[model samples]
Target: MNQLNVSEFIATSDFRRFHFLLLIIGFFCVIFDGYDTAVFGAILPSMMKEWHLTAVEAGALGSYSLFGMLFGAFTFGVLADRYGRKRMVAVTVILFSLFTALGGIAPGPKVFGFFRFMAGLGLGGILPNAIALLTDYSPKKTRTTITAIVFCGYCLGGMLSPFIGILAIGNYGWRIVLWVGALPLIFLPLAYRYMPESSFILLREGRREELLAVLARINPARKIDAEVRLYEEHDVSTRVPLAGLFGEGRALSTVMFTAAIFFHLILGYGLINWLPKLMLEAGFSMNSSLMFLIVLQCGAIVGTVVMGYAGDHYSLKRILVGMYLLGSVTMVLFALNRNATLAYVLIAVAGVPVVGAMNLVQVYISQFYPAFVRSTAMGFSSSVGRVGGMLGPLLAGWLVDMSFSIHSMFFAFAIPGVLSAISISAVQHRYSTDRSRKGQAEVGMRLAGEVEK
Candidate 1:
């Protein structure tokens, strides 16, 4: 008779069509997530003009959604851990999609801000939940690469926003670009149907039949006879999900991750929300400024693929540290750049570390905690990071208002990249749950891999 450990089975399973479906779905969902989040930056210039706003007010306005994300990430993480990932994903998609469209129709800044804040709640919740979903299903060996591929949808969305904005804003106005956000609501049903439930949920509920069915689908070549018995590899912890994030020797690392996310977002949002304004201030036309965003995002997409593959093959931590270092250098170079061709290249490199590196950080935190608390860990870290993200645009606005030269401004932004690298380096990797599980999963893989839904 053969005995089965469900977690080990899924972790060790071979790649299948079902796994590919999840990857494709995860990729597209995050693409929409990227689009909705980046839309605000796209419209920021127009909002400044129509609202008769100063740089400070516009930055403050951008922070409203960040506030919503802070609350949403924590709240959604707890709920996803308790209820399930798929349900929470649906709730957030609808929440952001509807309110984002509403923002387009808002009569004034107050109304627009309110709508954005509401949408921010959804935006805040989306990535953590989506990543958690993929983390649960992807094979442990290729998890970093798989998750990174799905995560790139975010940069792809960032790229999409400016391209669309340049075209539509000329005739249809910024509002038309936002109205496109509502498109995701149409795919909600298909996602709801196809998205797999967390195997943890099924195993916890003791749904042996359904769990077995999913395992069969995960590895169609595998067979289970009547002689086999199945067991969950890791039982659900009775302890509160948030509490677990700080337990099991994770407190220092959790704080370190939170801080790293904080600095990353500051650099990311500062560049994302303010780069166009910076370019425009340097005498570039609005379209040219927007084109810079597209180039930056393209660099992010390339960086994400390269770094993900490198992290998988080399040391994940080392790659992250190097990326942060590289990103900071790019910013300094951008400050000294005189040639247009070189400036474009510099902006692209900045995106690699500023935006692309965050995806790897997500991979790290997701793998750090136990399955029971993964979402909570990601959410709490992201929510706290949202505080920094909230401040990024506002800080940039203040920086722009000051009497400093553009050289000084780029130098200031580079500081956070260095801080982010330091934070990651300080994390205590000895306590990571993923490290412990890797050898165990590898052993189980040699036993012909476990399969799950």
Candidate 2:
């Protein structure tokens, strides 16, 4: 049988209609993730007032969902590696949507926190798998771009949440605002019908016939058949996917990347959760605060696209490092600036790296590991970042509780951004050094072989 590496087949294939369809399905899933997560921020004022929650209590309430996300990202990631991406994707969507609708009925803080936690589990599961599936389908020439495009769904959903809040939360109530999160159910059937199983998983299972058929559909001209045996770049014999992440001279890089994610997320989720409230405290009206969120998301969309394009052409690590540094500067500026027009402009700049960098990390981690462990690595990195995600809101709220100056609160948050930049730069330097050494070894071997001949 002719050996056909499914990863190679996919990485070399031309972009097709099927590819577009895959992007759409993953896109919508990300949108729901964005909307569900951001809605909490949008309606926080209303929810806090109704429940009479202290700032610390409100921060704790937000952390409950982030905690859920931490568990969900890790759990579902491992499950996706074991069970298959399609099933986990479907399961997570249903799980989060169900819990989101249930959130509307929550009578008090504990119950509300419970429902948010449940929904957070689903939120945690969706992104990594979505990125993994999309990565498997995409060509290398444009993989980063496609991943960013799909992630833009998240930015769109986040951008829309405030508008929904303006229209629905103001008139109806915060409960009604959360009820809309259930709307993803309408798209669930479409996702199930259209989403394909990960081709790499099929290859690993030695499902030749199925793999061939999938390959053919991805590119009809390839004429894949029974004679073809699917191959993969990663050794399938590496039975433990999680161990593989820490093996292969990858331990240090993995730890550094995870640390980078942790710091960046603290900055990212902290801003996302509190930006509206921070603006309100800064003397902007409620409506203006929501508008600032919209602008931030809008900037996020542009930043995601810009960074994706840059990543494809330049050093991905350098791009991230620069973005993180810029993010730190922008956060400091965002807090100090009181002029409405200037603050909007500063927050928009902040959004480019603060929010957009998270999307970059998704694409970055996907490229870092092989298909066998892609989801696991993504899940682990994101789950680690969830530590920051969980702490970010709580820290911000605590500062508010303690009456820390707003500008200084942001200055403290900026420290993580600086640390994130340093962490990513270290990874980049290691990667570059390794590549150089490998290149030198290859040249040495080639020269010796020539002399021997």
Best by lDDT: 1
For all predicted structures, in order, the TM-scores are 0.95, 0.93
Instruction: Report the lDDT of model 1 for residue 225.
Output: 66
Tens digit per residue, CA lDDT, model 1, 1-453: 478766667788877898899998888888988888888778778778887989888888888888899999999988888778889999999988999899989999899999989999998998888999888887777888888999899999888888888999978888988888899899889988989877776666566687778888888798976556666554464457888888768899999999989998998887888887788888888888888888988998889988887777777777888889898898889888778788888988887898889888998888778777888899999999988999899899898888567778888888999999999998998888867666656676443223332
Q: Which of the numbered candidates is closest to the native, going by highest TM-score?
A: 1
Question: Can you tell me which runs of candidate 2 are displaced by over 4 Å?
Answer: 428-453
**lDDT (C-alpha) at residue 113 in model 2:** 95
Clash count for each candidate, listed in order shown: 2, 0
Quote model 2's TM-score. 0.93
- Candidate 1: what lDDT? 0.84
Q: Candidate 2, after superposition: displacement of residue 155 in Å?
A: 1.2
Evaluate model 2: give its lDDT. 0.82
For each candidate in the order shown, give its overall lDDT on alpha carbons: 0.84, 0.82
